[model samples]
Target: MKIRASRISDSILIAVSGEEPDPAHQNISRSRRLLKLIAAFFSLFKLLLTRYRRPEFGSLRRDVWCLDEREYFESFQQKDPDDSARGQGGASQQEQRSQRGKGKGKQTARLEPIGDLGYSGSTFFTTPNGKYLIKSLPRRFEYKFFTRDLLDPYVNHMRAHPHSLLVRITDVVHAPHPTLGGLLGVAPTHHIIMENLLYGRDAEGGRFSNKWETYDLKPNDYFFPERDIADGRLAPKSVKDKLVDEFHDHVRVSAANKRELLRLLEADTQLLADHNAIDYSLFLVRYPGPRASTDDGADDAVPDNVPFVDSDASPWRTGLVDADGKWTYRVVVLDFFWARHTFRAWALTSLVKSFNKVAHKGPMSITANPADYRQRFLKMIQDIVVEV
Candidate 1:
């Protein structure tokens, strides 16, 4: 398999073939190139298809700054009901003027804008205090394209369920413009502000300490370990226990942590059981280390066996300043557009790898004691599966 970088998008197009054709053979060379081109085009097409297949709440543009942080905050303040200048209700002229001044005062502590904070459509911004993360949607897309009535019910279910890991929703803000291009036809721009992951890192961060190293894994590389365990070639007990201990440690150290992840997994299963969503990918992220000073240009090394402090449940609950200033958990729901297919299993598998890497130094050690932890984790996962 060969990967080619695309000039148009951040995604890389892949070309996988059975064997490399002989360069000396003109016909074989031409055929291989053609095949490669076709593969590349198809891969890019598939990504676009995936983007359009779901409702786009924001731009798919690779560049950040599509949504400016200060503008987003200004918009939110303008629309907030509590604001005196809020246009929604009838406020006296004096009240509106007073509120405007107060709102301006509140804006005094604004931080610099964050540009490339997300993996996909949205960009994340934090306040100076690091208590809230603003996920700004694009200003061009239709709101209905991404939102559904199911969201409220789904969120409520997660809140009510003891085992759900879903993040809490605090407030929803409508932007002045649609975040998606050309899709906006009088649809207001919008953003969802909710509980940020308070006490944990993203799934990907947990898997590998180094960013470049994690991307080296082929598709098959991710699945082979589980296959070995299933076939009895790998010890299941050992893996399970290690996973359990790691999860326990992650929760114990994190603040405002709850049994939410387990519950969210269970809720996902139920959603799948009822044919409510589609399977989608999810990942976790961690801060590499303290910011580099002006005098030092070197990347901060993530310490080994360092106990992380999870400050909040999600980034939305915290702010941009909080993310940069402190350690926190931000559980992002990547596949909200296709809620009909739940990717609980894949997520769990990924989580297993992630937690083990961060908690146990590498792949989880499936020793006798580790096996017990493994069983507990498995049980938690199984209970969710059964619920689904």
Candidate 2:
């Protein structure tokens, strides 16, 4: 299979050139807007939810809690709330997304849109400081993901496979059936907070980001980055070659690292399949090389671009560095365990897939059995990982 790496270019000339008018664009935009509204709405709602949802202890998975205003958002230096954002110390109707933490003790969560996100809603954002991701999702999906099928077992699963590539859900601010309703329905809206995978968001994400290279990997079609093929396009064939060439110039890991990555992928995906869930993607990132030594923040990070090489520098290939160096990853196996296929849902998805329409991206990701999911995932990797 030909792996054609795609990129996010503002030049939609690529995506729009031959495409027919898409009604989905409205949905895509509205969904994105709803997503943004949720983020903003929650910034205001946080004032209330925190009162009830503030941090809980004894857990890192599915932990919920509020940033105590006394400790997190309060400060003598805080500006008067805007006229519209009066509640919960929110900016009145006229104020900005996050209150500026400008005073001597003012370290309130300064929020802003890093960019829009999602398949339908482009509604994902991160803190300016590059620490966390905050966004909302449909109530039903959120509920299912954190309960019996996903959240609890995830803890034991991660424990059993310590190196699994699951990004832990750190905290959440859940609204019980908001009066305003979900973007499309009456379902609740959940604000998910987690570690910023890949990189943190600053004000400039729409234009740029801290990420240097990111491959959002899924199972089929072409080892991801499929531009022209995945979506109808007639772009150049050299796209993959250019990207691989670029990857090798900056990153090269050893055999052990490759195996470790594959191991993690298999374990994590199998876990997803075990739960009768699928439709997730693997995000592999290559961090930027450190700035010049003379720069002031040089000491704070891994001095840019230097791949971490362990004792056996085995030349890890595939996705960033090998086992030796700084593990070239900001992995988050995303979009999983939403519907518990229970016995019924899984059976339906499996049965429908059996009729053999185009593959639902990857079937195991949907409802295929765990063993089958794991085997297929690993087999695909074997086919692609060239003697790394």
Candidate 3:
């Protein structure tokens, strides 16, 4: 596939196509000319992008940052976690500091994968401090369009309500070379840097250890239950354990808080539905309330760090706790870039490899029409936000 992007006034124009893959064809003829133009184009893009935070949506700014192909290390940052974690009886001294002390200079810290590996067939990794998430974009996704559609509404929501539940997207990245190189059945990769819903509050030095129970939730008949889960097989055990945890079946909050949560959810989903998007799940995380004890779920042992979560991630702070000791939920709809396609579009595009299941049912299923998708999406969200 051939991919290229250029800034168009306030928005960027991204064009990706699976025209021809043969290196022989690409190296010689018009493809070579296109490469030369691209090199010149992006070089110009870097220089011009300095003032181009145009129509900036909070941190949802535009840039073309590259991942170094050379020296760099992943250091899951941990500062003075030694004595506290030891006293708390969390992970072993060795295990907690495993990824640290092995880096140098700018390699001091990097994003690390937590929870489930290869969740939903996409590589899910979070920043060392758990403030940002880096995930693989779908082959069907048009990043420029996706960014524009979601970012506009997201910025507006943040501006109006301040701490909204919408998952804030700060930046979208286009890594030219394959980050997950030679992975079978995987298409060209474009990563999205999203504000992690777990800890929107950016803490000092980015060292966080808040024990949170997380779930990617959807209503019944949503097809969210994978065959692996159905066949009594669930993955990345860390996440699966919490997925089956009884305490998290439903979030407990006051009626007033429930109403507020539902209202925010509806607004976020409406934005997606209006854009003809579906197959998104509301990611729910439960933090410890004042009266609630924080535990990392290791029986007979106290949990790790109580993260003073990142405060810079403004939108996610809307998960307000009530006067009662019941848990509050930090919820955001995720994976809305999976678009429904027209008959002609589907039939024509079917030739390429598909990451998504074409036929689906219920709320999790996608629709070809925007209006149809909107109704189904709203209905499911309304069903989810009940008991208010």
Say which candidate scores most in lDDT. Answer: 3
Runs of candidate 2 with Cα error greater than 4 angstroms are 1-58, 61-108, 120-122, 160-162, 182-188, 200-211, 222-252, 288-328, 340-370, 383-388
- Candidate 2 residues 1-388, lDDT tens each? 0110011110111111112335766566777867755664433222112211232312333222222322122211223435111112433321221222134222333343454444424345443333345555554554555554576677677556544567655545444334343433332245555545543212232222443466655555322223433552444555443322122332234566557667777777777767666555655565433332234344433433332211111122212443334334445566664554555455766675664465444343445555565566566555545433
Residue-level lDDT of model 1, residues 49-145, one tens digit each, is: 1121111212111111133223222322223334322112233333433554566412212322344332234545443223345454443222342
**Total clashing pairs for each candidate:** 69, 37, 6
Give the Cα error of residue 136 in candidate 2, in Å.
1.7
Instruction: Pick the TM-score winner.
Output: 3
Return the TM-score for each candidate structure: 0.35, 0.53, 0.54
Show where candidate 3 strays beyond 4 Å.
1-106, 115-120, 138-145, 148-161, 176-188, 200-211, 222-248, 293-319, 342-364, 368-388
Q: How far off is model 2, as Cα RMSD? A: 14.4
Query: Per-residue alpha-carbon lDDT of model 3 for 1-388, expressed as tens digits?
Result: 1111112110111111011145766557787777755553444222111111223532332211121111001112322344232122223334333422243112222345442332345555565445457665545344544665655665666666544566655545453432222133233244565656654333333233244566665433433334334453654555544332223344445566667666766676676667666656667666555445433233422122334233433223445453554454566667666655534335533532242354432333433345555455556555544452
CA lDDT of 183 in candidate 2?
39
- Candidate order (lDDT): 3, 2, 1
Ranking by TM-score: 3, 2, 1
